[model samples]
Target: MKTKLFSALATMVAPTAMTVGSVSADAVAPQTSKADFSVVAKDPTNPTDPENGTLVLKSVPSFSFGTIEASEIYAGFTGKVAKTAGALEIADIRLGKSDWSLTADMAQFTDDANKLTGAILNLDSTGSLGETLTGAVKDDSPAVEVVKGNGKHGVDNFKMEAATLTLAANPAADLAKDESFTTTINWNLSSTTPTAPTA
Candidate 1:
């Protein structure tokens, strides 16, 4: 009887088994991919891909002043402006105030024979989220910086309105009748390297 009572007491006092190994979880840095930039188009309908974290110059506007009459061609004569032809778009996948610069320059208007002498192109911006990108681009000089900085905090998609193009210079001579001329407006973008935030 005494032995049975001792056994029961020992069984009641037995210890429970336990596992003692360590368990852990880990995290890694985020990977960012960029989307290829599309050709500049007026009234761009391309969607921003924040998922790809694209920090790029998405598109720039292609303006049309339409056909001009030789008699009416003069300084400050901006021909019949096409509707919604000057919306420049940017794609940003960034942290904090991401700095960027957009520059523009123009080529001389050319006919089949020669350049249209003394003609200048001026871009007038009506809307901008940050810095206004309005400037004149002469064929003789380097591109002018139109806008600098996002004019906002953090990453975002932005639209810079380039409202109209004014013919700032008069041709030295009268344009030949029925002559059509073409020119190019070159655009460039600059991105500053970002620094990580610290506590």
Candidate 2:
């Protein structure tokens, strides 16, 4: 009876089994990838891979005065003025200034050794965006302000025409033959209205 009573007391006093081993665990945090962003101004010659907010000189025309006859030269030839060829197209975004102006040099036709003696280029831009020109001008002269606009800052085209052409009498009196001449038209752009350069 004593043994049975001691066993009952020990069972009531003993505690339950417990686990104390180390537990393996790991934690995770959330984050995002980072990189630098920017835009750079570049020449617009090629538009294949253009990025956003890019400005480019899209297209321009090559003016050509076709073959002239001796009879026409004697009477002073005049060629047709048309924009059948491409016009000047400028592709701009809102990144450019709200206003812009264009300046171009009045080019003179000349060959390797001789200039067209009395040839004239009349740019009659009276009602157009360009300046009206009615006289002969030097090639190396200061660029002439041709076009100006206000409050328009985006892609657009400008038409160019040759109002008239007067050829000089043949000084050499030689038989009529093919003659080719080229002139460089230097173009300038400005954000503000450009004043005509003083002589």
Candidate 3:
């Protein structure tokens, strides 16, 4: 009996002694991973429309100078095209590469009668927008730089204030009754320094 009791006590105490030994739980971390990302600009809706969620250049409105009496001596007339601030807005949303600019064509005004040569439109460079129109440009010549865009996304907003077109008149030009004159002023937006568009 004494031997059996001792054996039972030993069996019970054996588990307690085994628990005194060190028992370890390991801690580990999984390997890291990465994900790639990219973006694409949306296409323009129409020739006259601005693109969605991307860079877009809108067509400029036609400028009209009311009828003026002709003179034998050289004369000059100036017409305001965009007087209100923020009238001209360029929308851009490119990521990382956000440099852009604008160019306007210097052109001669033409009458339907094929007369009035040497009449040119002049754009003033100094004005409210920190010399926005610095120099004059004409058609058939290199385009005039309009804007050195601020590198940004939607945060960048630009407009021209007090922009005008001056018409230089020559006396020898032939006259026409109710004569109409028209010229196309092309505007281009580029990611780099701009050149005039091809005729």
Candidate 4:
């Protein structure tokens, strides 16, 4: 009976041991296997060549004032005109004082002087604000002066002070009969520079 029991135990153990050895052999085979790789030559030209093209940079600066007109007027009379009874007509008034303001476009250029020299300034027009008297003066008259303000620069930007307009008498206009005066105000960017304010 002991001999028969020993024989049955050996048969069961032998098959279980063989199954474990088969799994172990499969795992060891992966460790001994060799992996193959390859290397190729690099292309002579850059991959991003077409996308990395050349670029050109240009600087354009310009400035202009708002459409200005005679908003208010105050006239004074002298010697003989003071004794007149009735008020003077708007057309006939002489030696009158007028006040007007221009809604200035200050953000056209980073520098005032550069904007004036780079482009022409016109009144209420977009294309080359030319120095033309839109109201009652000729085109060639030198009746305007380009006034510049104190320049202030912050970071990468700069601004100029308010440009004041002065109207001088036209040389060709009639002095005696024609009491009307007209002039053009040009914001010249050619003379813009950073400076301290005057008291």
The candidate scoring highest on lDDT is: 1
Q: Candidate 4 lDDT (Cα, whole model)? A: 0.16
Cα-based TM-score, every candidate: 0.57, 0.51, 0.54, 0.15
3 or 4: which has the higher TM-score?
3
Off by over 4 Å in 1: 1-52, 74-82, 126-128, 151-162, 168-177, 194-199
- For candidate 4, the 10 contiguous residues with the lowest summed lDDT are 3-12
TM-score, prediction 1: 0.57
Question: Candidates' lDDT values, in order?
Answer: 0.39, 0.35, 0.35, 0.16
lDDT of 3 by residue, 100-158 (tens): 66665534444444333343334443322332444464544667776655455453333
Residue lDDT tens for model 1, 52-167 = 33344544543334344443443335533433332455544556555766675555555455454444445565334555656766654687887666445333333333444444
lDDT of 4 at 55: 11
| Candidates, ranked, lDDT | 1, 2, 3, 4
Q: List the residue pairs that clash in candidate 2.
A: none
Candidate 3, lDDT over the whole model:
0.35
Q: Which ten residues in a row have the lowest lDDT in candidate 3?
A: 3-12
lDDT of 2 by residue, 1-199 (tens): 0000000000000011101111110111111111110111111111232233533344443444433444443344444343234455444453444355555443444434444344444454432233332333234466555555544545566555653444555344222234334444444444432212223
Q: How many clashing pairs in candidate 2?
A: 0
Q: List where candidate 3 sits over 4 angstroms from the true fold.
A: 1-53, 72-74, 77-86, 115-134, 155-161, 192-199
Question: What is the Å distance of residue 151 in model 1 from its true position?
Answer: 5.4
lDDT of 4 by residue, 1-199 (tens): 0000000000000000000000001111110101111111111101111111111001111222222121111111111101111110001011122111111121111111111111112222111212211222113333332221122111111121121122222222112211222112221122211111223
